[model samples]
Target: MNQVNVFLRQRKDHRRWVALFLALACVVAYATLDRLKYNGQALNHKQMALVCTAHGLVAHEHNDDCYDEDGELRCPLPELELHEHDDSCYEEMAALVCNELESDGHIHDASCYERVRDEEPSCGIENDTHEHSDACYGWHEELICDIPEGEGAHHHGLGCYEIQMALACGLPEITEEHVHTDDCFVEIDMTPDEVEELVEERGPRRTPSWPPCAARTRWSIPPS
Candidate 1:
């Protein structure tokens, strides 16, 4: 009888262990399934949403005019809910524009003087008593000079005056004159033919279909 009782207790323990293992397995499976469903839903949402610039041009908050002509004119990506400005963003754009204007030679040489500062040697004329001196400086100044304060020194920085002007003017509408990209209206980076091809490739979402798209697309929201 003692031996039989011991055998029964062992059998019961085995059954309990099996039940526990099965329960654990079921819990793991449920968790996994839940995770998969969540992931799938997220992916679906992303696929349905529209893609836009970092400034959230398509976003409704800041009034940025970003839109989508491609993929069936679907509403702007829902993920881009907020539109805000960034500090360096405008500055970087200004730099890009300045570089472009300087390249075109439409602006004066003084506009890009800062770019080629180190290309020339500086002359020591702090007290140049001549009226014609006018603190004359040029591009490509390699040697450093100790000119008096207020002397014309090449402020070779990231951008030039023309760039600042372009930024101030703001981006133009995307059209035959100014091909638009995901970022901004680009005139210098690509040639005419290349620009056309890029516009076609990026689709209407990037360049937009109208000449006044840029003005319409300006957003008031700041960067997220």
Candidate 2:
């Protein structure tokens, strides 16, 4: 009877040891799985930091945050911030920065200046302020009459007229029958020398016997 009791006690002790060993194994397995999970998360964060660094951004390890050079946060996507500018000036890109600068009232570049100049109003003539006549055309900064070149066009004050009127006023031969008047002349700033030079260059100057009015009338309705 004493031997049997000792055997039973030994069996009970072995079963207890087996249960303890199984419990220890389960605890070790749980700890190992938890450690692996932590290591995977750390590796993912490291990869994100490396990606941010490659895109010229600052990466924070504590919170895995990324920021641009201007201190603006651009986490999870640094590429989107690459083309953005802080001062609204897109110098790197080949896009027009005119609208942005104009809205902010900032100085413009060469291209923007040209765009503004092209958008200005113009009347075909530079600095033209006066009304133009039907027979005149815009010439540089002045409105000039479209008088035929060889038909005796001469400048008088700020106008152009036929050469016959100029000759009738006071030239080589003064006709007693023809009298000079403002109606027969076009106001201009032309000199006698300039008229003479023009005449020499374009054939000879024509001389008229009648006054400018009579000549105009005769030329308009030929003698029947």
Candidate 3:
């Protein structure tokens, strides 16, 4: 090759080496900084991202009161043990996290969070059943049982009625056997008319029943 061409080639090769070395130096610096931040020595993007990912990107403020403190996320309150009611709160946080991610161009990860939020019953519907069913039933029975007085309150199986009531009241489900003090308690899920037919066939509660209201409560007086 000509002398000028060779000299130019050498310069180009030198520039390429210089560029490669600079890139390597930058990578080493970034890696070192990342390591330091993760070890709690510094606050860096890598550490922040990793922490956020570990926490599922969802910042639940209701239960934990997670807030930004000195450029870092910190909880002002102590972590709470999740209860049935916390489902809604978790969903809310998940929503916030997904929204934040989406706004920041983290579309794929945000979509994953959205899916998770959607699958979780965070509307308090599932927890609603557990809580209400547990409380009202607690006053009446040990186990999750049907309401003792059948037909009086139609549409729900007496058991279903009791379960519904307990759930409405936010009581958690229990396994205690459900029993009533009344002498004659029926277990059936029938309409008002069906209940009337059943009661008429079985006869009314025993006279002067041990439970004061048993006779009056069990007798289905036809609605005028």
Candidate 4:
């Protein structure tokens, strides 16, 4: 009888050990899933939901622009809800924009400026001072800088200007006789035939289809 009791007790202990192992496994799995959902890498619906919720952009908040007609979560605001996950968020200050890398979730801190662009003035200033060089231009009080390609620079046709510096842009004077360039127009050094081909190849987007359906020059600006 005593021998039988020992065997039963040993069996009970074995069962207890199994149960404890299973409980530990359950806890580990739960913790792992939580980490993945909030890791801040490539986000999915559930992960993005958590982020949007924190920012009050989830359902009926101020900027409730989430969800298209298809019920997809689209975060449109510059500072979307990824700050907790990625640990970095894109925020627009008074005149400047800033980002935090933690929102990216380095959970290591990083600089938003370094990750976003090649240098300070991607507006095309090569130096730190951001002076008006060949690539940078001034329109009214605003800076009308050129975006540099390999050899040349181009301005995307963002038609917001105050007309501060005219002579600085010596392509063609805006006067009736000269017309340095028309509104949102740029001068190309290409021959007329080449310019026509480029316009055609660019399709109707660069040049609008409403009035002319044509691009006039090689110096085309990008769309905002």
- Name the regions of candidate 2 deviating beyond 4 angstroms: 47-224
- lDDT leaderboard ranking: 1, 2, 4, 3
Runs with alpha carbons beyond 4 Å of true place in candidate 4: 40-224
Tell me the tens digit of each residue's lDDT in model 4 across 1-224: 99999999999999999999999999999999888866533232222121222222221222334443345434323321211212122221122111211122222123212322223333554665656543444322322334322323233233422122111221211111111113312233444455458547855432111122221222222234
How far off is residue 54 in model 4, in Å? 33
TM-score per candidate, in order? 0.24, 0.23, 0.20, 0.21
Cα-based RMSD of the predictions, in order? 24.1, 42.9, 40.3, 35.7
lDDT to native, each model: 0.41, 0.37, 0.34, 0.36
Judge candidate 2 against the unseen true structure and give its global Cα lDDT, from 0 to 1.
Answer: 0.37
Root-mean-square deviation of candidate 3:
40.3
Over 1-224, each residue of candidate 1 has an lDDT whose tens digit, in order, gives: 99999999999999999999999999999999999987775554322123334332342332233332242433333322332433322432222222222222233234333444433335645555743232354555232333433433343234332223112224332212211244542224333455457557867543323132232122222222
Highest lDDT: give the candidate number: 1
Best by TM-score: 1
Q: Tens-digit lDDT track for model 3 on 23-132?
A: 99999999998887665532222211111212212212232123222333233222222334333222111111111111222222322322112223333445434643
lDDT of 4 at 182: 30
